[model samples]
Target: MATLKVLGAGPVKRGITQIAAEFAKASGHQVNVEFTGAPTVRERVFAGEVVDVAVVPAATMDEFAAAGCIAPATRAKLGHARMGLAMRKGAVAPDLSSTEAFRRAVEKADAVVANLANSGNYVAKLVGDLGFAADKVQRQPDAVKVMEQVASSPQQLLGAGQLPEIRELIDKGVAVELAGPLPDALQSVTAYDAAVAAASANAAAAAEFTAWLATPAARTAMAATGID
Candidate 1:
């Protein structure tokens, strides 16, 4: 078996990294996993980086395969993530139970922190739909960064992103508490998938590891990291 270089995006970061570690331990194979923005991951793969396996949005897995960046037959479904809201611990968790309530909370917040990638893009679109000025939304590099900003900032804020990312913050005691999932009507689910890179020197190992992501132990690992 050869060393596996795994490229992953924001939403799948925590879970996939842990699962990869478990795979490495069991298989005695070294797996180097890098977590970054979805766009960045796509760019890297397109740029011909050493990506043996890619864990990204399902749609991206398809696009990459179509573009000949990854092996066409190597795709495997991972899990889904839902956008949600978070607030610093002890702050009033705003009412996001309904669309109207959620809208008002976003409007009233001193700052609404959101990621600049998937969840962030979704939020930016929502902000436009609500007719709010773009300046009202503060975009961070990723969900964890949003939590970091909200935890350290003095202003009252509401952070919105994938529930798993928010949970990652709470798990690390980042002074943030989940408000809850977005209003059911507005909730957006992003499913993730993994595939072996077409250029991988160790395609066999990569394919085997990609398949392992669907195993029971992998699900447990994903669940442990707040990914379902």
Candidate 2:
């Protein structure tokens, strides 16, 4: 067994990292996981930084693989992400029982931070479907950054651009409850996947890590990280 490394966008990183830890400990492998933006991973890989694996939105990897930077056959779909809403700690959860309340909360907030990645894109489309003006939304590239924004302000409201991040904020007392169900008009149900870098010298170890991540034991550990 060899050390397994992973680099990906923020939302799934936490839960997946936890799951990876358990898999490594039980499988007798060392694990080093790095969380980053979608574009950054490709940049680093092209720059020759060594990495065993990369996990990113399924859609984003097609171009890289097609260009021969990533091993296409080594890719495996992980799962999907759902969007939700949040507020800072101690702020009462908003009543998102209806579209009216949800929209009103967004409009009334001091600032509303949305993601620009998978979760954020879904949220942006959601805002449009809900009939909110473009000026009403503030877009950020990462969900963790959004969480940081809302959590830093007790009065600020935050929207979960993705399921994993929304669950994480609530669990960590960063925000209040998530908003209503992420409708398709605004939801992308982001497809996540693990792919080996073409330059990876540790393909066998990387493949093993991905396999363990898909196992029941991995799911069990993920549950503790607000993965559902």
Candidate 3:
């Protein structure tokens, strides 16, 4: 049996963790995953961090392959997740039925909380394009922290991040609930990809895990956590 270390983006944490457990059970391999923002994943890989597998945004994975951090041929698409909103549990959910409604919701929010990840960056730009002031947005380090701020705040806040991440925190009793995904016209879906690291000592086991991520069972697990 071999142990495979996986470094993944925060948005895919729940789905990847579920798939990792299933793979570990069937293959008798110990799979450990560290979840953080995509930028942090790239930074770690570039800094020479030794990892067996890496899962991040598809574009970032391509960058890794080009930089010789991960094997290009081993790359596989995981899935995509849509950006969504969350609010403290029991709070009146915002009207995200349409783009205009979304604009009104943001305009009425006491504060807009978002992570400093890809999803957050997109939402920040969308809000700006809608003519909202940048100062109204409070950016956190990651999704977990973004939810933490929303859950702890007494003021009415709109938390923005990947739906899977928002759902994960809500399921963990984080005092938050999904406010619904951004209105269709204003939605953003981020695609994710996984690959075995070029410097991995457990490349074979890592490859097995990455390949299994596209299997039927893995897709089921991913969908259960909001990953499309």
Quick one: best TM-score, which candidate? 3
Candidate scoring better on TM-score of 1 and 2? 1
Per-residue lDDT over 90-129 for candidate 1, one digit per residue giving the tens place of the 0 to 100 score: 8988888899998899888887888878778888889779
lDDT (0-100) at residue 131 of candidate 3?
A: 95
lDDT per residue (tens digit) for residues 45-156 in model 3 = 9999999999999888889988889888788887889988999888999899999999999999988998887788898889999999998889999998999899999999
In Å, residue 122's CA in model 1 sits off its true spot by: 0.7
Question: Candidate 3 at 76: error in angstroms?
Answer: 1.5
By TM-score, rank the candidates, best first. Answer: 3, 1, 2
Collision count for each candidate, in order: 0, 3, 0
Worst 10 residues of 2 by lDDT: 179-188
Over 4 Å off, model 2: 46-48, 98-101, 128-131, 154-156, 173-180, 183-185, 223-228
lDDT of each: 0.85, 0.70, 0.89
Write the number of the candidate with greater lDDT, choosing between 1 and 2.
1
Error of 3 at 1 (Å): 2.3
User: Stretches of candidate 3 above 4 Å error?
Assistant: none
Tell me how many residue pairs clash in candidate 3: 0
lDDT per residue as tens, model 2, 46-80: 67777888888777777667777677777866666
